[model samples]
Target chain A: MKKPDTAKQMTIARLLLQGNEACVKGALAAGCRFYAGYPITPASEIMEAMARDLPRAGGSFIQMEDEIASLGAVLGASLTGAKSMTATSGPGFSLMQEHIGYACMAEIPCVIVDVMRGGPSTGLPTQGAQGDVMQARWGTHGDHPIIVLAPSSVYDFYELTIQAFNLSERYRTPVIMLADEAVAHVRESIVLPEAGKVAIEDRAGPTVPPEWYIPYADPGSGIPPMPRFGDGYRYNVTGLTHDVRGYPTTRKDEVEPLISRLFSKISKDIDRLQWFDSYYTEDALVTVIAYGSVARAGLQAVKEARIKGMKAGLVKLKVLWPFMRQTIDAVMGNSSRILVPEMNMGQLSREVKRVNRGNCEVMTLNKYDGTLITPLEILRKLEEIYPC
Target chain B: MLETAHPIHKYLRSSKKFPHIWCAGCGSGIFMNALIRAIDRSGLAKDDIVLVSGIGCSSRLPIYVDFNTVHTTHGRALTFATGIKLANPALKVITIMGDGDAVSIGGNHFIHAARRNVEIASFIINNQIYGMTGGQCSPTTPHGVKTVSSPYGNAENNFDICALAEAAGASFVGRSTVYHTPLLDRLIDKALDKKGFSMVEVISQCVTHGSRWMGLNSPVDMMKWLKEHSLTVEKAKGLGETERKDKIIIGIMADLDRPTYNEEYDRFTR
Candidate 1:
């Protein structure tokens, strides 16, 4: 394993950068060569940065007509063996769901950055909200598994963008970087790493001859090497369920394993697939579970509660899909009470409750008015539960 | 009878499975033949070309040719083709669509792609009706044309595709018809050689759909109508706007220098 040079160069410093800007830098460092997106607020900076930097790095950047085309272009680029991505917000993300499912069904490796704003439909374009947690998991129709990662800070926006790419390439699936407006617009100091110092993952290419290659046939790693077009590999890939040869298959025998592997590939490899940050859970009777920008408030409230002589801990989820039930259950299992805060009406909280199975009371603090969850409100909830 | 010589025929096999899905005498086959000829003449290897299409009868052109092809969703051929082009700019990307596929459902993508001037050759087979969907009035269906959707007559005015292409900022825009075989062959050849967004709108005959609905029984009759209605751009220039308004203008409408979307995009990254 090549050690990241910057891993040893520890200078705990900061640089002011927007969350979207950080995402662009992280994408650049991760060897992303193509970006196709339409400009939508809170996420427009990502497009601007990519439009400026992609060409300089000998990559491609395009402002497509709409979010559908943006993601469609990214998927098309991914098939040609390019590290491609696109960014959008709520309404745009809604338009991209169909193609997103296509990427999932095709097992194409690409990234979609959703800098979420409040919505059922263009509710709040400038404000932050985590209402898309359920949408990120179930936006696309059908029973397909997805990888969704949420970043809490500007630095994580950069760091997680790289991880999103790596995970997509590793799993051969569309990995979503789900960010809300707060993180997208937030300006913070992020240290730039020297070149050749960040970990990157490249998609696996066919090791066998083109004739011997089955594009969708897994090679023990649960990911089949992709052979690009114009590489003398003639294969058919459809949005329909397909067999190893990439041809659409409807046989009972073929359908079972095809769908089963889609779930198992990510589920069985949960260790490398899941990520979260936990705090102060050693002897706490009360815990808080949150993600994205809301988790920052959750962490602060936990700290405040600890100072007020309340034993409160935090479970900040990074990976939001395949639910990470075991990790979540383990962290919140012994707690007397758990607070699940989000920008929506307890979407993630419902998942927490479903997995908790009555072992601990799962309470929800949801705000859907397109505002970030305030640390004070969370503290007030904590005080009510374990009154000072 | 004049013999049609298309170079792409050399790469094609005349077999049972290869008979093609186009109706017997449909002009789309002629355009497809011309495209294959252009591809063969370009000297680019067959393996290096990627043909993308949206859902429509004309969009089926890619299925007959031996190349990397994607028959994607309706009106999304440009988006998919754009993706393919960006991924491997080395691979020659060509997209084919019909009137509705390119102008109606796919209009947003079409204009934006042209505005960006992505390095792609978009061939819009303008048969004036949605042939695949049973002769519904299309974006290019002429006003007063009777069809399934337009029972009495098509109330909407048609879009002049070449004019639209020129207005949308395509570096190259040309028009031809199945009747103007030699000119179409030359136009397609030139369009392929051009480096930016090249769009060739081929006026075609949907005899089985449009003609049957409009009371024309045979493909020959439809072909005859196309020949009589089509005029060269030079001929149309001499006529008054009202006189030649509805005439199909056949020739290259615009060809100018502009950096392609990929070229401009690459500049930003560097």
Candidate 2:
């Protein structure tokens, strides 16, 4: 196993951990004190791990009636100054859209882990599929800003879960860790990061006194410090368009600014939010762009393509949303063709095609048959894209 | 000036522009008044109280109150309150939901929250009709009542909010009407102090929708109707089933000491 950079100052044990188990460990490491979720396949282990570990780590866990209530509970706990999260599959994630929009509008910091399984509705319970990519972005109504991170491996799941919390806390918005069934259930050897070795971020609290605290005042940062419910700062938080004080409002000026600020706060800091890895992209005619478990296959296919004397590279995305346009543009500028291999009907590939602007031939390799995209399948697609 | 001098005024947010949106003779204001009076009487620190509400005319009560308040989505206030109660366990969490918000769209959360028996005071103001969306028949709209959604003499049966709470395992359940302000205040007080899920179903009048649609012309007419229709739980015990028909039983429906969700969670976790 490769030694992780976060593992330092102590002898770390290389333990075999599943992707869902890694997520629970990462959440605990990041000071997550509250978790509320329902059981859904591929995601049930995440909720189970949280239920077992959260109590031991001085946090709270609740199995809500449904995904809607689960997310609602997480949002409530977040406002009480607790780092909170929930996990679900496709159908449950669909139910959570209502509060996901609420979280975006209210600017409550929380995390949601969508362990993908096949679905329009309960399509494949135990099997894997990546059908919720667009749902994660546009599931919640309105043009709300969201951060979605896609983890490629079990170790990546552990690290990105922590990153998801950091980003959510720093931005005061919801972060989604979109993992497919393959990576979520896969067991792999991963070096555990030492406690306090990895940097953990806590949401900024009101520096001003209770009376002086403006719950939504952004002093130019577009992000404001939040106060807990019992922090003596008696404030109102509503889903409606509101002013700096957090009261419901319909005035054009107040409504316009609140909406604009929510987007600007994250979009402006796109540089910090975007995370990905490019392999052999320095010199390649064809590059494969993918995320989650498919990205792992993409990496292996790229190596096989190189051995076959075909110039194939891979761009594995860690942060999916605010879609790394500049990086994709850079790949487009260099590569003659782009191949996006995913588990859905070209969800991420559609974004790549939009960004491509016909600059390069953007091809897609999609499989939604509740199976992982194999390296051989991607290699075959690469061979078709690049004549070797 | 007189309104500002009122004791409950101190609990109202000075910044929120309010000549509240409730129509003239609306019982929502009456329930809001009783709620604030009860909170004030309890002497819980204002900072230690969190009032959460779902979307409705009744849900707007939290915005006017000077406490840590959250006006959440439709029918999801109890879920949010459950989180807050478990997170702090010290903050007095209260939820105010309308009839439609509580028993219809949010019915699943309502039953589950009660079943979990989280330490939350849920005040469901059953105005019978959806007042905010203009007089649609709610889950609590009486059977055969004519409203916008059920204009041709309704076919659906109404939910008994208190009985539902009792069945769902809420530790404390009570019913009161706007006409019974003292009883409402007392019930609100008991709910706030209860250890587990405490539910108070307030049979309130919505002058604009519920009352006008029901042929009750004014708030006074509705209050008189409530007074005439409701019977104390103690008084109903002596009456036969036929005699109690159409009577809205008011007063404490259930009060049993049970282990709260938070207390039980803390018992093992801590």
Judging by TM-score against the true structure, name the best candidate: 2
Among all windows of ten consecutive residues in candidate 2 chain B, which has the lowest summed lDDT? B1-10
What fraction of the true interface does each of the listed models get right, in terms of native contacts kept? 0.55, 0.94
B107 Cα displacement, candidate 2 (Å): 1.1
Candidate 1 to truth, TM: 0.88
Instruction: Summing lDDT over every window of 10 consecutive residues in candidate 1 chain B, give the lowest-scoring window.
Output: B10-19
**Which digits, one per residue and each the tens of the lDDT, describe model 2 over residues A94-208?**
9999999999999999999999989888799899888999999999999899999999899999999999999999999999999998899899999987778899999988888
Candidate 2 TM-score for chain A: 0.96
lDDT for residue A161 in candidate 1, whole number 0-100? 95
Displacement of residue B34 (Cα, Å) in model 1 is 2.3
Error of 1 at B190 (Å): 1.3
lDDT of 1 by residue, A108-184 (tens): 89999998888889788888888888999999999999999999999899999999999899888999999988888
Docking class of 2: high
